[model samples]
Target chain A: MMLRNTSNAVYRVAYESVSKLSRKLNAAKNIDELSSVFDQYLKYLFNFNALRVHIVVGSDHYYFVFPLKDENETEFWENEVLNFEEGLLENGVPICQNLNAEQANSLIGDDVQNPVLWGWNFQYEDYCAVTSLIADENNQFSSKETEILGLVVDLFTLKYYELITKAQLVEKNKLLEEAVDIIKQKNNWINQIISDQQNVIDERTKQLRYQNEQLMQLSVLNAHQVREPLSRVMGLLDLISFVEGDEFEEEILPKMKESAKDLDEALQVVINKSIEEIVNVFDINSDKM
Target chain B: MNRGSNVLKVLLVDDQKITNFINLKVFEMVSVENQTIDYTDPEIAFRELDNHNPDIIFLDLMMPRLNGWEFLDRMKSQKIELPVVILSSSTSPEDFSRAEQYNNVLDYFTKPLQRDDIEKLLAKL
Candidate 1:
């Protein structure tokens, strides 16, 4: 009856520990958070002195080691882990072994005496995870314990995939926001360019109006003032037509010469004035530019 | 009407000496019997208007000292009854309208005055 009572207590403790470990794993948000949870809980649940986790997704490998005993031992363990062959643990198999100092030295280049080694391999989709645990020979793992540890490794693999997927989603959101900001900036720049072009059109319209006014003024001057001398030349020519040869030479030729000179001078003045006005308009436009 | 006994008196007033000379030549070509008086200055022309007692006057519009419009106004005030014609280089409609407002102004003509225009005036006389 006492043995039955002791077995009931042990079962209750194991059930409580598994519930607590599942809660901690579910609460983990990132790699660092999950790694800390594993470091805190896995050793206590499985009675391991040290732990190493190696996960490979695509070309990337994520590795973690907890409670490193010494630099030499860590170096030796790292070499063994790097050279470890696959297929040692099959899909449904878990490995648990006890090693002497000589065996440990041959495997890991370390003289660790009577070490207990346990490892498991798990795969989900295209990703793989390999886990290793080391303990003192006095604390050899049972088959039931190895089965429980296999379940823990599987839980870690699923949590790791969740953490990586969440991180990728966050990175994509940041990139999308940056792309939107760039589009908004380009739109603003195009609006500014359109406004500047409108201003240039308005300025050109004003200059054209000014030039039209100058042209009208020049037209008026040409019609009235410049035409006066031309009329005199016409009048002189009419008189020459009326008179005979010698009379035309003596009487009308000198007057015709004078009238022609006056016409030439008037035309020159008008041309110079027009050129001056055009130059002034160009100078004003250049200054604005 | 009595072309043999009575001489036709003609007067010309213009700021341009060339215009007056041309008009005098035209009158000589038309008839040497007609008396022609010409002046470059409108003020002198205005003072001599009664002294000349011209039968017909050819007046230019734009002149210094006294313009054609002012000369016409003075002629009105002095009650100088004479047939006056505008002989100007201006083709402005406004000048033509303004000259038509005067009772003494017989017609408006743009220069240089043709033989046809002078013959028309002679026909009126």
Candidate 2:
């Protein structure tokens, strides 16, 4: 009757411990948060002295050790654990255990009394996470206790995968935001260039209109000024034709010479004005540049 | 009238002496038996209007003392009835349009005047 009552109490404790651990694991948001939760509760839940979690994603191996009392012991355990993982990988097994007190003492050290090493190799897709639990002799794990520990480890592995996936999503969102900012800056730069070019084009168009007006004025001036002298020459020639032979030398010759000189002077004025306008236009263009 | 019975009395007013000389020679070439009087000063020409009693007056537009428009204004105030023709170096449309506004302005001619222009004036006279 006492044995039956003790067994009932143990079953109830195990059920409550697993339910609490499962709740904590589900609530974990990140790797750091999950690691903290495991560190705080694993000893109380399974009575283990040390806990080691090894997560492998691609070529990278992440080691998470708990209650690391001695640095030297941690280093030694890490080498041993790596060797054990390698052996498991070679054999293509998912779990390995060394529960003998004598073998555990010889392999690990005297610090642990009756150490029971439990290791698991978990794979989800291409990624693998291997975990090991070590118990001291004073709180040596029974088969029932180790089964509960296994359930805890399984929960931790699933939570870890969830945390890693969430971290990757956050990184991708940050990169996408940076890319959007760069594209906006480039568009603003291109708009500024287009506006500058439009200003130059507008200025050139205004200058061309002014030049056209000046050319039209010049043409009108030429028609009036040049025609005056030409008309005088034509009239003088008509007079020369009408006059008798001797009368031409005395009367028409002097007037003809004067009219020809006037025509030459008028032509010179037009040429000078045109050259001045051309030079002014060139100077205006050079200044713009 | 002083030169002959059928001869016309012609008055020529220009600021340039060379222009007056050319017009006088053109009149002689056309074989017009007329009494021609030339004046370089517009004021002198206005003063001689009564004495000459010219049948026709050829006037220049641009001058130092008095421009053609101002001369015409004076002529209008004085009630002068002589047939005046504009003989100018300017072919501006504004000048032509302004000349048309005067009642006594018989014609507008851009110099140097052709024989055809002189002949037309003579025919009108």
Candidate 3:
């Protein structure tokens, strides 16, 4: 009866030693941070020499050891199990046993006296975990401590699930932001292509309008300027037979020759204008291309 | 006039004076006894239309200041219904079709006017 009273008194003192739990847990970003949080608080919550926990979340197995050699150390691996963890996770039942000679020698050291080990397997909706706490005769873990161990395990495991879910949500949000950036870049590229095509179409329409005006000018030159002198030549040619000798020589022939020369000059002018028009149009087209 | 008391009075209008010379020569070759009044300036011809009192008129299509169509339009507005023969250098189908719309256009001929063509006109008169 005295041993129970002393154990209860020790637990009360440990609980009072712990200051803030939620503040520490809120600052935690990863499981490594949570590991430090648990390390600081676990000793105060329970009486144990060593604590080990193994949790399986998705395909990853998280294993941690308490009473860390360095407070700043943070390293966790997947699927790395110890010999003691195998027995702890062996069955659905709870274990409270005194370590045999060989087992005690391997876990602690051969020098340590009678060490007792306690293990429990916890089942949750998404995952399963196992935790073990070791004690010795100097620190007596009676049936009362065993009952308190259940409550402590429950609280730790619930906090661990919250931290894992928060981490996964952050990973998914980062991926979403990257996808939105790519879509914005693609939209800008499409707008640039559309504006470039519009500029090309406008330039082509301008060239076509200029060429059309040149063609109209050429047609008017062909109809009026070219045909005017040509008609005079035809008319004088027929007058050749109408007159007598000196009148034909001085009057008719000279007039016909002059009309023919006028026709030739008109044709030359038209030809020069056509060449100039063609060169100007070609220049307008090639400069852009 | 060879046919006495029925004198053929011809009015010739052309922008080119050289073209007018050729038409007048053709009229003389035809031996048609006619009193001819000719003008290189079409506006002069349009002003002297009632004074000339021509039985038949020869008109050129293309001209400076006043073209054949504009002269004809003015003549219609003045209500001068003289027989007119279009003597143009143009052989365009559109020009021929357009001349058909003028009420007093008796014939359309491309220049220079031949002796045979003058005979046909005198026969028509």
Candidate 4:
């Protein structure tokens, strides 16, 4: 498939979501808040967390800072900070920050290693101000939303590959079908040739049978009608060949020789016809027998 | 210092550190007096833009989290109608066609963005 005409609007929404989530993840005070926000934001957009989030904070007061026990403990610390801020605010501390108690808690859960310091104001010296570093261990803050979006892109890419493979399979199947058809056609032709050969053999057998019957019929006919006359003609031709030539005898002898040759040729034709009839009769009798 | 206020402030957005450095150098050599806010993180980039309004944006098309087109879309939604020049190594016809669809995109340039290219873009401004 070709690259989709992705709406600039969709791209913008995805981008802003990523930016917002990244900002939130960075603003988060501990690992607990980070993972929760990460999980919540990503569950909607993607299935995997491709971009690993790492949070580390450098505390202003080194003695008060506690080591991050684990990811779960970090979330707990963030929750505690929220409760602490709310308690302080309810007691009448004038804070100009726009974040609500819930929003603040959600923003900076237990992900940070140190207390994030905001800009210090001389007018509010009594209140602690801290800025949060929204970063992984490498100081990179890839938002949970962004990570999920990356996963979506990956899944889409895999789907595209699957489509291509399916198309290839379809083409291969078409070629296979054509090959099968050709093979079937060749088989039919071979079968037809075998049938024709069988037909030819049957015709030749019929002809041989007819010829054998004819020879038998001619054998009977030749015994009565042909042999006696043919024998006499042959004797006369033999006599004419032995005679000497004289003036008057020569003319008479030539005529006699011509007549004997004609008779002999006629007898041979009669014998051949008689034999053909005999074979035909014999072939008919053989079939009956 | 008085003339500095009149200079164009160009924001260079890219995930790679070296690309940002190279672009910044090119901008400088073009005699364009400008301050660049480099954002390797696309999410961070939007915040930087909201905070510091730049005269021009040189945006890369590909990145880990927020791609160039995504960033532009976000910027447009926010009504930040600043001049945006798409800086990408992809010169595919389809890429160019897609870039053309965006009204905010002043031009599409194939990268290693040169000083001459920057100068040419500045002249257009």
Candidate 5:
């Protein structure tokens, strides 16, 4: 009653297939991997020659049809389901229906015998599975074999939650790695800015020290050289008071004129030397910039 | 010149003939001429240091062939210890500080070497 195929002692083989399917589903890393596992194993769970399942979760839809003959692969898509599956989605319950020859031939093509269609609709939370199975007299399900159907429903729910939780965690981990990468880039940028500022400060201090030394040299030159002849002129002017008018005209007066000329020349020396030194300092600073 | 009868024998050494001539007039102003010998060339004056035998040497600092510091160094090397009064036209504090390093350098004066400077020299003498 629980497994209709037990008459052939095939329940052991079906049990092993369902156990392998559960292992494969749990071991699967992503939706694509889970889809491949389902394609390989889901048909072996029940007594059906042909199986068609349409599953909908929110806006995502998956449809898989396995017409197993000569090891044909499962055809899966967002495919349109059979007319009986539309009815089963609306009714939200199990259904046993006799599929006429035309309807049976339309799916597995005239290869079936006395084909009967069984429908199972299972819903949990926002998820729904609409499964329509066609089996002929060759591999028919007893109406009372709800135990195996119940086991399949439990596996679907468990597999769905496992893959969904993994998917959410993977999405969140990707965002976390992106955030960490942005923070590292910002830290490098901040360190670069700080180093640039330190270099600027060091350059400015060096230039100021050089300019200050140049200024001190120039000041010493001016004080000693420029002041020399000017003082000589003043000295000659003071000599006027002691000398007689005739003596002053011959001695102090001509000497005063000469010292004045010397003062003018000394002024030029200071001016030219200061300009040259200032220009040199400016050129050095310009080269650095 | 109230020089206390010791009639100070003075030598004036400067690179400028005009500066020496002006210093000659300072000696005239202080009424100490005939005791003063002036030389525009410091090297000539350094060579004639013994012959002139002056009680005081008014030495100009900046000159050709021998600068004041070198002149002082030459005098030191020759053991020519004389009372040297530096008569430079520099009012720099560094010059004032530098002059202190010479043991034979009696005083520093920025020109003109006026009658007051001569009086101070006489008093110090």
Candidate 6:
């Protein structure tokens, strides 16, 4: 939004008024100084209402945060701020003449929608200085005020912007510090969880290794035991086969077949046991790996 | 009406009258065990706190005259240790953490008060 040429005269007058107000505001050291400055500023800026200004000042800005004075005073201030916008500009043209306080409500009236034209925002950034014209109903630049208000506003804004920038930097620094602390906290917590999980893993690995050793010993022992049984069954089968022939064609042949069956059963048991042992080792090793 | 030792006195603080009304109804119908006194004005609520040692307090955050955070600050400065339960529609994580930071807070519950939630919460009490 650049400054227009139409509102040169009015912009200077408004800027002068604002300069006076700003000087008073800057000079104010205490409540008394503030009150005096605010009184003059309100009178010059808003002549429509009857009010006495009492406001609270903070480090960066003024807070209407809590009303420190009589409740009636607030109503008066609102009335002035609202009605000023409802009034006319230098031109005969009405910003929103058809609007009424009861029906349209000043809050939603011409000032809010188009403040620059109505001179309602005389204290607004640009208008506060004398560098810009108050825009018209069509938002055209003021033929009377021009860019004087804009210049003053720019100057003041630069100062205020610098302060705001510093504040923002401080806030950002605080946020960065907080983020760092949170990251540190999360890192510590994750480390703790990892350590706990590692301990459990170590304990489980030790138990599994011991169990694997025991199973290996059992497999070797069981293999030896199966071999002894198989050898006994084989010897019996051989003796029967040798005696069977013609003399034992009936009873001797039946005994030889029974011995062979026992030997086959023993060999099958040994093969099954070996497979089971191999599978157990594979499962344990796969899980650990 | 009858009075007993189990009959508890509770304080309800919020700027919104509708919220206070709904909370009161819920308290009468759903609260397992407690009596209540409701106040819309935060300043008045603080005064009521001083006068009445209520069993529990249900507080809201945003207010016109005095905000909930300000009320809490005052209470803390004054060393007023009443078990406060934050009853707010705001589910901001910062608000939750802030409530936790204070020792006076007993619990935090979001809006649209549920019957089962209140029952379980009261059962613990």
Candidate 3: tens digits of C-alpha lDDT, residues A110-170: 5446878777777788877787766776655666766556655555666788888877788
User: What residue runs in model 2 are displaced by over 4 Å at the alpha carbon?
Assistant: A1-15, A68-72, A76-81, A94-109, A142-150, A203-209, A223-269, A284-289, B1-125
TM-scores for every candidate against the unseen true structure? 0.51, 0.56, 0.56, 0.30, 0.53, 0.29
Evaluated on chain A only, model 4 obtains a TM-score of 0.31
Specify the highest-DockQ model's number: 5
Could you tell me how far off, in angstroms, the CA of residue B65 lies in candidate 3 after the best superposition?
9.3
Model 2 reaches what TM-score against the true structure? Answer: 0.56
Give residue B2's error in model 3 in angstroms: 33
CA-based DockQ, model 1: 0.36
Alpha-carbon runs more than 4 Å astray in model 6: A1-289, B1-4
Question: What is each predicted model's overall lDDT from 0 to 1?
Answer: 0.76, 0.76, 0.75, 0.54, 0.76, 0.55
> What DockQ class does candidate 6 belong to?
incorrect
Q: Measured by TM-score, how close is model 1 to the native structure?
A: 0.51
Q: Could you give candidate 6's fraction of true interface contacts?
A: 0.00
Tens-digit per-residue lDDT, A1-289, candidate 4? 1334455555676667666666666555444564455555643343221222211122221101122333333332342333334334345332233334444345445343322222111112222222122222323323343344444323322333344346668899999999999999999999999999999778778877777676654553443234323333333343444345663265334444554565466568667887666676677667756
> Where is model 5 more than 4 Å wrong at Cα?
A1-14, A25-37, A53-58, A67-132, A142-223, A244-254, A270-289, B1-125
* Tens digits of per-residue lDDT for model 6, A101-162: 44222323333233242222224432221111122234333333223433333434444444
Model 3: DockQ vs. true structure: 0.27
What is candidate 1's lDDT per residue for A144-223, written digit by digit as tens?
Answer: 67666767777777788888888888898898889889989999999999999999888888888888888876775675
Model 6 chain A is weakest, by summed lDDT over 10 consecutive residues, at A48-57
Which of the two candidates, 4 or 5, achieves a greater TM-score against the reference?
Answer: 5
Candidate 2, residue A195: how far the Cα is off, in Å:
3.7
State the lDDT of candidate 5 residue by residue for A150-225, as single tens digits. 6665675557666776777888999999999999999999999999999988888988887888788777667766
